[model samples]
Target chain A: MNTSDAFHRYTKKVCGQIRWKKAHDIVSREIENHLHDQRDAYMAQGDTESVAEEKALLQMGDAVSVGMALDQTHRPSPQWAMIGLVMLLSGIGAIIQFCYYDNALAAAPAGNISIARFAFALPLGILLFAAAYFLDFSFIGKYPYLLPVALLGIDIVAQLIGVDFNGKNWLSIGRFAISPISLSLPFPLAFCGLLYHFRHKRNGYLLGGLFAAFFCVQLVCFHTMSGLFVFVCAAGSLMLFAAVRGCFPGNTKRLFLLFVVAGIVLFAMFLWANSYYAYRMNTLFAVFRPETDPQNVGYFPLLLRNIMEHSVFWGKGNPLEIADYSAILYSGNFRADFLLTFLSYEYGWGIAMFLVLLLTGFLAFGLHKAFRQKSILGQMVSLSILCTFAGEVFVYILNNLGYPLIAPIALPFLSYGTTALLLHMALAGILLSTFRTGEVFRDKELLTFLKPPLFQWDNGKLIISFKG
Target chain B: MTMDKTLLAGSTAMLILKLLDGQDMYGYQMIAELAKRSDDTFHLKAGTLYPLLHGLEKKKLLESYEKQTDSARIRKYYRLTPKGKKHLHEKTEEWEVFSHAIHQVLKGGLCCEHI
Candidate 1:
């Protein structure tokens, strides 16, 4: 056999039997054709048949290497990951529907299940199914960057239908009965995907334009302090990533122009959309004199007092529960507070600090790997996610201390919401993808923790090392 | 003249475009043409050639289709698009202007003596 044929045989042995016929067939055919060509070339060079074949095989390198390279090319794309996400979300939606509406529906007159409940669950369930189905077909893989835009469309439709027909809050679908925030999980997932895509592709103009449009739409549609905060944080994080990654084009003048335009538009939209910003501004300015607005600003003091009075250094069972209860008792906002109450109340001070350290350490590790490994995209995504996390932490801390006017964004991994789940999952996906790139921490030495100890005592003497 | 290997490698697209200006060819044929045109001076490595061809194909600058030769061997044939031709022409003109300017500066007034 010629070099190509030898290489093909080697590769087949290395890769084992590929289960997917289409992929396996294509790879096998390519190998066969390549070997044939190499054989012909060797023969034309006037070598004996055996010698030519041996020489051809020598030129093909190790079979395993060729098979690995081909496998890399044929590796399934993010389509599978997307499908998994959609299925997970659908499962979550089904569970939520069954839990909240099942008993209520059974008790109600037949066909009179609350419009609010149905409105909240149906669009969300449909959205999850549609996203999953679309992902399975690989429709969104080509334009992964556009996934967020599609999600935003779903959120808009869900919000419009929920509010107009069901008379429910955009976030909490019914009267504290059922929430559609789970449906909004796709938005954050899509956002993470977009960030990943843009990091690799660096289409700054498109990203900038999309952010601007999203900000404008959020301003018009919701006009809530929470909405404005989400828009600002999301847009700002993307822009920051773009800047750090050197994806944003244009030197000083152009950069200045873009920022100015963004600032002006954001300021104008904030002004037009809601008056709550004024309250937030006033509360921020009067942080020390929180008692002036006791019901709003004083909520934090009351919660802190409750925590301090109720338990010791570690405080309650879960900082999250304490925070939730405190919010309900003091601020009358039973909605889960992302940072302040959850961290301090549920995990308590010590555990919360430990959790924070662990999270920060993981993020730092991801960032170090991303940058050290020369993955600009990974670095950008890590940095952007880090910024979001930082902002969430900051807002939560401020809200806990005294700035209750600031809207809560659920703490990372601590809050139980669709957005939080999607965000964490996306973060996991990004880190995994970065790992797969083989840019970071590939050396066995870096994973020394997983290995057995370097030395072991045996019969009163120390054995230096263990053999592999 | 000694060739800058890095420069030649970097300008492989230009070299490929220049070669394809004369004829359409399959990957192996193009590789052979490159070697022949350069008087056996250059051989495109498989690792580099496949990725470059794939990239070009992705960018729509080149289109490929399979055809059976007289020997009944199926070969993938690649040809430049109208857009590719225009891009090649523009890049060629730019490269010529750039090289001429560099040559003039490097020669330090000996350029006119050669002319």
Candidate 2:
């Protein structure tokens, strides 16, 4: 057999026995190249072609032994450390959710809905995580149109039958309740797929990105202002990514002008749309003009500032019990609005900082791994998801850090909303699966850890040591 | 000689890390360099070296990337990571202490012999 043929037979014998079959191609290619190089070196020694091939093959030692050693090297091992960290963060948040809602369940006629939803949402989120982890994350990219199609479908349905909740329409499914606007959570992945598909065609890139942004705005305008803000921030990050890769239209200088002009137009149109959005602007304006709408629009901001005035390094934590019912209830019902104020007023800033650090760690590592991916599809999806994570965390913290609460973003690990919990967990699972798939890159490393070294010992005396 | 085939197993990873400490090289280059430096006393077959190089990469002690040469062939290069360099330094110190002990024993120069 030719050198190439012999190398293939050897690789098949070894890699075929390994369970992580995805790694066979890389291993086979690498080993074949090695064998060919060796055979050439032998030919330089003036050996005949067949003899050189034979000697080169022989130098590799036993075929079965080498295959087995390689097979031991390429096994798939899950990263439990990161998974554990995510679980711990989520668990702490769930505990706090339970404590607050459980205590308030007796006093409030709403029957502690926040705590109940958070508790039920945790397991569902985990189930989503498990499913996403096992299933290939690239499935989102497989049908690149899936996320956008799904988003448009949800938006249409919500418009048709969505019910009003706290001035915004929320879609309910039979007995189950869900906010249609929150469905925008997965929009980034779909948007990334669009960008990935049109990464070459500059026109398609611009059109697809703008179309994706418009759809996100459509979903947000009908439901929540915060959704629109989050979506815009995420889209901007993706644009920056595309610009850096030279995928954006014309140059980045033009793109910056487009952003400013678009911002002004959107701001003008947003205020003119409805009294609901106008009222939100008034709330923002109330931040500076405190006397503008005292006892109404400006009330919560005043309450937040008062709460911040008594800041401690470590938070008091979620109140043991809602001692001052009027504290949260009477001042424009700031239960959800001032979540940070409540958190700092109860838990301490330390918990908030810790939660943010944990999430930042997860997102940072996930992005780092994804960027390392050689495939553009992988990088796009990873960047999209990471951008979403960063956007949510940043916006939420900004709103809390003495800024007018323009939006109430659900913290990754600490928030109590079912929609937010489920969405975060699902995205998290996708990131984890991507990281797991990265194992195929280190097939050589996996084999090393999969099997222990062979050591011969007689009464604890070292006789032979085989590393692989 | 046949029995000593397994002798390279335990130290193969360590040796590979040492070679990759400052310089980056691929599988074939590593084998040829190791053989050349050891004066042909060590023969690291293609099979043995590839697996060991890959294993070190998996452990994250070494990282690999491919470079394109003028010959139009892509050669995969390996380098020591910070973790790997620290490991190599520790192992070098360990090997010295271990070999020094072995040398003392072989020369019948153990202090315990006087006792």
lDDT of 2 at B111: 39
Provide TM-scores for the models.
Answer: 0.49, 0.79
Write one digit per residue (lDDT tens) for candidate 1, span A238-301: 6655665566565656556666777787777767665567766666655666567656755555
Docking quality level of the chain pair in candidate 2: acceptable
Give the Å error, residue A358, model 1. Answer: 3.5
The interface RMSD value for candidate 2 stands at 7.0
Model 1 chain A is weakest, by summed lDDT over 10 consecutive residues, at A438-447
**Per-residue lDDT tens digits of candidate 1, residues B2-67?**
666797776788777777775787665676788898898777654355446545754667766555
Q: Which residue pairs in candidate 1 have backbone atoms (N, alpha carbon, C) closer than 3 angstroms, thus clashing?
A: A3-A56, A3-A57, A318-A345, A318-A346, A319-A345, A319-A346, A319-A347, A320-A346, A338-A410
Off by over 4 Å in 2: A1-3, A44-52, A100-120, A164-169, A200-208, A242-281, A288-293, A311-333, A347-354, A364-379, A441-468, B1-3, B68-74, B104-115
Question: Tens digits of per-residue lDDT for model 2 on A276-343?
Answer: 77776787788777566768887656656656555566846333233353355323234444555666
Best by TM-score: 2
User: TM-scores for chain B, in order?
Assistant: 0.85, 0.88
